[model samples]
Structures are given as structure tokens and as C-alpha cells.
Target: MGSMEEPSPETNYTKPLGIRFIEYIKRSNISYKTHQVIVLIVTFIAYASYHAARKTTSVVKSTLDPASDEVSLNSLPWRRRPFSWILGDGWAPFDGSDGTVLLGEIDVAFLAVYAIGMYFSGHLGDRINLRIFLTIGMVGTGVFTSLFGIGYWGSIHSFYYYLAVQMLAGLFQSTGWPSVVAVVGNWFGKKKRGLIMGIWNAHTSVGNITGSLVASALLQYGWGWSFVVPGLMIATIGLVVFLFLPVTPESVGVSEEDESDSPKKSGAEVTSPLLISSRAEVKDQPVGFIEAWKIPGVAPFALCLFFSKLVAYTFLYWLPFYISHTAIDGQYLSDAAAGNLSTLFDVGGVLGGILAGHISDRLDARAITAASFMYCAIPALFFYRSYGSISLTANVILMFITGMFVNGPYALITTAVSADLGTHSSLRGNSRALATVTAIIDGTGSVGAAIGPLLTGYISAKSWSAVFTMLMGAALIAGLLLTRLVVAEVTAKIEESRSRRGSTSRSQPAVIDV
Candidate 1:
């Protein structure tokens, strides 16, 4: 087996200070189990911080364009609109009548670039050291996130400035999901990946919740602080990730003996026939984009996720605005209150992700689990849109349910499903495909993510009902996309069950007669 010391002299020279620190730690008497735990915690916090920063824009949107019926800036005795602002009302271009559409455009700019960048970043992640790739992404994301906030204090209202910053931030954000998923997949195998990743995936909702609370809390001070604080947070966590993240077992000199003993505790079955054979001979070549797309389940799951993300991200970016604009029991919520309330959706999402993962693992059927979630989300969306305005309790309950169903398949596909496809048997244990496959699936989904928010902006001006209809239709389509795969899994499961029963009968009858 090759040792960590086998890298070229140039590669060693270019190693970050964090990699050196990790090497120093590895010299100590640490167990493989300890290293596994650290990987989980560090990656969790790192990605969560990324989401937290991404979420700031959504929470602060209402403050950028306060509703006309609400108390105006002029009504406040202590506060006055700044003279440098283009409009004496709210923030310039964004505060205008076309503000919602502009907001949607900004979302499209960010997510469109994000979707495009994902393809390249995935390829890069497979070739380069993941720790370095991930750290650079987080830091870049922080810088751009803060730059968006800096525009407020600088009295700069150029629409292009915000648009450009968002575009850059999206590019950086594209690095996060693929890198982290690849790292986790490196450490774990397919034994119970769905359930394990499902619980781990809570980081997404947790980050959203944290971002909403933090941004909402700071809205009273200034909208800029909302972005600045989260920006600083992700940047800080990036430093921590650079310091301690181990890219793979081989990188830390974990012995073969340690790996053999570690899977039981780690929930990874490292001894699986495929993995065992693959690890026997190291393949330096990574899978190409065209090759990854050719993998059997990859294309269908990717398409399903496209529609799935459309529904989920629409709510992610615009739900707070919707909550604040629409009345609940004849009362409209303040920006902060609405932002805070929007977190219930993510709260339900956390649970839904875990439940979906557990069900998929138990059934050993990823497509069936994902498709069912999408089917349920249709009714959930309808109920929330129709009855959510009736009362606060009803709104919360319906919204939570809607979030659960909408995010369930999304969570399953992005994490467990992507990992599974990346490590499919046809690859013959070529683990290098993990990042590229993950990128293809998620990159395709991001296109829909961009479209969802962009369309919501235009459609919302007409009627919120139309928006609900679009979401429900998307959810239905998402389920339909998975039908073929779901049927295959069902048929395979039936055959396996019959084989097991036949084996049990054959093994028991002869001995009983004797």
C-alpha cells in the first residue's frame, strides 16, 4: 500500500498550514473511530455554515422591500431614509414595484451560475485534495457574502454590484456539497447509508434555521449586519475545516487492520465484496462527466431532483416574503417575525430527511422512498396554500407538513442516492466517481432551483395560488420521473425475498426429517 509520504515534492511544498497541523495530530495515538467522529462533526459544521450564509438573503428580503400597507419609514420618529439612496422610501431598485421580480432575478443569477459551476467543481474535487478545495470554497463564499452586505453600508445601489457578488458567491457555494459528500462517502460504505446520511443531512435545515434566527435578530440594526455576520461565521469555520479535515483514510495512515475493525462502529461495511476488490488496486483515474451520466440510476435521479429542488428552493427563498405579505387571521407578520416563522418549514424538513432515509434503508429501495415523498408533497402543498391563511396554528402545521414532504425526497436523493450511484457495482470499485456523479445530479437540480425562485417572482405578482399550483405540478412530475426506477427496485426486492424463503425451506426440511 502507498503511504502518505509518497506525494511529489511539489505537492508536499504546496500543502496548507492546516494539512501540516493535521499531520502533526496524526502522529499521536488516536483511534480510527476518533478520526471518523471528527470527520462527521467537522464536515457537519462546515457545510452548515455554508447554508447559514446562503440563507441570509432570504431572511433579509422583506426588510429590503417593506409592504406599503405597513408602517412606513416616515412614520418612525427616530429613523430617516438615507439621502444617498436612490429612493427616499426603502432600498432603491429593490424597494420599487418590480422588487420581487428583481429579487427573483438575483436568485436566478446566483443559482444558475451555481448549477454551472457544480460540474467543474465536481471534476476538480475528484482530482485535487478535497480539504483544500472545500476550504477555498467556504472562504470565497464568505468574502462574497460579506461584499453583498458591504454594499448597504457603502451606499452603493448599483443593481449590477449585488448581482455580480451573488454570482461569485454562487460559484463558491457550488464547491460545498460535492466536496463534503465525497469526503463522507470516502469514510463510509453502503450498509445503512440512507439512514446515516439522513441524520447527517440535518445540517442543511439546521443551517437554515440558524441563518434565519441570526439574520432576523439583526434586521432591526441593519440588513447589512445580517449578511456580514453569517459571512464571518462561514469564513471562520472554513479555517477550522482546513486545520482538521482528513480527506481519506489513506491520507492519515489508518492501517488496514483499523479499517477492518472500524466499520461496525462507523456504520460502514468496508468489507463489502465490491469495495474489497476496488481497494486491492488503486485507480488514479477519475470518472468523466459523460461517463458518470451514463451510470444507470444517475440520470433519472438527477431529473427527479431537478423538479424536487424547484419546489423546495422556491419555498426556501420566498417563503418569508409570502408569510409577511399574506395575512394570518387578519394580521400580517413583521419581517423578523416572518423570518423566524419560516424556520418551522426547515424544522419539519430535518425530521422528514431522517424518516425518508430510514425508510429507504429498511426497504433497500431509494427510488420508491423518494417517489413516495414527492407524491405526498403534492397534497401537502395544496393544503398549505389553501388553509394556511386561516390561523397561525393551521399555517404552522400545514407549512411543516409541506416542508417535510417536499424536502424528504430532495434530502434522500442529494445525499444517500448520489453516494450510492457514485459507488455502483459497474464502476468496479472505482471510488473516484463519487464527486463527479454527485455533481451531475446536484448540478442538474440547481438549474431547477434557479428557475423556481425566478418564476415565483413573476407568478407571485399575479396570485399566490398560481405559485402553489406550479409547486404541486412540479411535485407530481418529480414523482413520475422516478416510476421506472421504483418499479425495478420493487421487482428486485420481490425476487430477493422469494430466494431467501426458498433457501430457508431447503436448509430446514432435510434436517427436520432426519
Candidate 2:
């Protein structure tokens, strides 16, 4: 019905049918606050759908290639049980001896493609109508995801077919994060960004929990249902998004009311729209990917996220399979039980993201908050590995705690921190770098995410303890990478406190003489 890219502030793009209808009904009564609410709701569900699709493979892993026995160190060899809850023989090709390796290959392939695609997606998102870009990505993702499930019905055992579908799905999935984050950044200011984005970022965990529950519940009917349902859900939501998603404040003729919206310096020739009270300049072009990365804090945060996302994504892709294979109090869980149980981790992640974001906002120091969370994760990982199998209750508690600590920094880095950097003061007044900056940081992290699962797939076969060790080490590295940034934040705070005290003493008019 329309072109892909929205026209600039100098020109008006035709509004979507849904938006045109909305404006006609509300007319001048519509307020900026109302638009903010709409933006949050739409973006939240949109990204959540993306995560729902991403989490399906994890839940379906044990079903695709059930093993004959438990690999836990505590279990007696004779006490072993079959891995699959429903599929006795498991799916062919994947059921072979090399099945585990094949699954790992699929994980790496999908993640690698996703990581590569992220860089390009960000660059493209800035220049296009974010709504259209996001819609095409979601629909394409749905198509590929459903195709993976359709293989089971078609009785297709070709490993290459599944691999191809997953790789394509990953590429489409890359379009989601940069698009949603940029949209949200465009609407809200940086004043309460930490708390707001932290709460908003829960979409990731919410999506995960939804995927796990839906995929797990549907597993008994068929493994194929897991992927197909989430696939359909995201595609449907994508259409809703296309109809209603306003890409910018100007899109809806509203103004941002925060200081961050004003330009600190000048760069772009155009001024913010009269309807939108922003500091932004209408740049003739979007920021280049490499130029966005050159912003002061971008590289370090990107590197830090590399390790942070590694630890988080490891649990995301493997926790269900790990739970199904390991015994809790000498009893192994069914595939469904494990899949359902894994939701607790994401439940905890929801808290962690909100907590981390709130803390960062309150402290006004993103680095310190993120680093602290990463450091705490080391102990949580150790405790979970050492004591989680003692009982189901213990496992749940430890898993939730581990998830909280592990995902806290990851959520922070990807959300509020990315937004802050994208709109860095150095950008002058240019507001076009949000998607690019988000892509650079997250794309780097996606590489680590891919490596973690691939490594876990192999390491778990030899010894699960070793996998925990790797995760702990990664968490440590993540925290350590932020050392310089954390130190700088601390130093700045100390100097500010001293300066405030000095000013107070001067204003007291000779307290010592009194």
C-alpha cells in the first residue's frame, strides 16, 4: 500500500490506514502522553513475539534427539532413562549418533547469520520506515519458523533443509532489536530511561517465558507445534505493528518533553519538527556503522556485552535440555517439566532487568550497575551448579538467582545503555544513530551468544560441570571488561560530591568563625 521508508520532516509520508483512522476519531484531543503509551505497548508486544520464536528451538531440543540415558555424574549408569517425553524413537537424522553435533551446528549457523545480519539491519533501519522494516522481518521470520515445523509433517529428514530454514529465520530475527529500540528511543527521553527501558526490556524475558510455556505445552501433541504456534503469533503481531506503530514523534505530531531531546551541539542542518520539541537536527543522512562505533563508550560496552550475552544465552539455549538430562534428587524430569521449569529463569530475568535499569538510572552510572551485576553472577553460577540438583525447590531458587545475576547486565547493556550511546552528546543533534549503535553492541553480543550454545552442546556431552565452569569464567570476564568504565564513573561521582560539599561550605558564610 505504501513505500518502505518514511519521508523526512521536510516532507510528510502518508500515514497508514490504521493511524489515519485513529487521528480522524481522536482529532486534536490526542496528547503526547497517549502516544507514549501506545509506543510502549506496541513495541513491547512486537519484541516479545521475536523472543517467543527465538526460544522455540531450545524447548524442542530434547525432543528432536532424545538420548538413551542420563549423563549426570551423581546418577548410577543403571538408573538412566530415555530423554524424550513423547517421541520414543526421536526424529530421524537428528536421532543419529551425530545428532548432538548437528544441533550445535544449527545453533551456531543461526546465531552467526543473526549476528551478521544485525549490523546491516541497524544501518537499514535508520534509513527506512522502521515499521515496514520490522514488519517484513517478522513475517519472514514467521515463514521460516513454520517451515522448520512443516519438515516434520512432510517427513523430511534432510539436515540441510532444517539448517537452511533456521539460518534464514536468524537473518529476519536480526531486524527486531534495532527497530524496536530505535522506536522506543524516539518516543521517550533519557530522564527515567533506566527504569523505563529496564521495565520495557522485560519483553525479552516475557517472550522467553511465553515461548517456553507454549512450546512445552504443545510438545505432547507434536514437536512441530512448538515452532509453528510461535511463528504464527509473531507474524500476526507484525501485521498489527504495521497498522499502528508510529516510528517517531513526528510521525504522530507529538513533542518530547525532556532535556535530552534538545541538541547539545549542532550538526544536522534541519531543526526538530514544531510538533515535536526535540534537540534533534534533521540530518541529510544516517550515521555510518563505523562512525557510530567510534563514539567514546561504544567499543568497550560492545566487548563487555560479548561476554555478558554469552553467559545469558548459554542458559537460554541449553537450560531446558540440561534440566531434562540431569537428575534432581535422583529423579530426571520429563522434557515438558524441564521446559516449563526453565520459565523461572526468565521470570527472574524480568526482575533483574527492571532492577538493573532502576539502579542504573538512580545512580546515573550504567557501567557500575552492569559491572556489579556481572560480578554477582559468578557466585550465582557456582551455587547453581554445585547445589541446584539437591532438590527441585533448590534448583528453582538457584536457577532463578543465577538467571537474575546473569541476565541483569545483559539486559542493561542492550537496553538503556545502548540508547544513551546511540544519542551520545558527540552526535551533536543527529538522532539517526540509535539503530546503528544498538546493532553494533548487540551484534557483537550475538556472536558470543552463538559461541556459548555451540560450546555447551559439545561440553555438556563430556561433563556438565565443565559447562558451568565456562559460564562462570565468561561472567567474570564480562565484569572485568567494564573495569575502566566503572572506575571512571566512580571517580566522577567522588569529584562531584566533593564539589557539592565545597559549594555548600562557601555558601555557609564562615561556619568555623561561628
Q: Please provide, for model 2 over 386-418, each residue's C-alpha lDDT reduced to its tens digit, 9 standing for 90 to 100.
A: 899999999999999988888888988998999
Residues 1-514 of candidate 1 have per-residue lDDT tens digits of 3233444465445444565665555654345676678889989999999889988886566566544223221111112222224323567667888775566568778888999999999999988989989999999999999999998899888888999999999999999999999988887777788888999999987797788679867767777888999999999899898887877766765543664647755777657888655675645678899999999999999999999999998887678778888899999877557767887998888889999999999988999999999999999999898899999999999999999999999999999999999889888778888889999999999999878877876798899999999999999999999999989998999999999999999888564554
Off by over 4 Å in 1: 1-27, 62-101, 217-223, 255-282, 324-337, 389-391, 510-514
RMSD of each: 5.7, 5.9
- Model 1: number of clashes? 0
User: Native-vs-model 1 lDDT?
Assistant: 0.83
* Model 1, C-alpha of 312: deviation from truth (Å): 0.9
Clashing pairs in 1: none
Model 2 worst lDDT window (10 residues): 71-80
- Stretches > 4 Å off in candidate 2: 1-14, 66-90, 216-225, 257-282, 324-337, 390-392, 511-514
For candidate 1, the per-residue lDDT at 301 reads: 96
For model 2, state the Cα shift of residue 305 in Å.
1.0
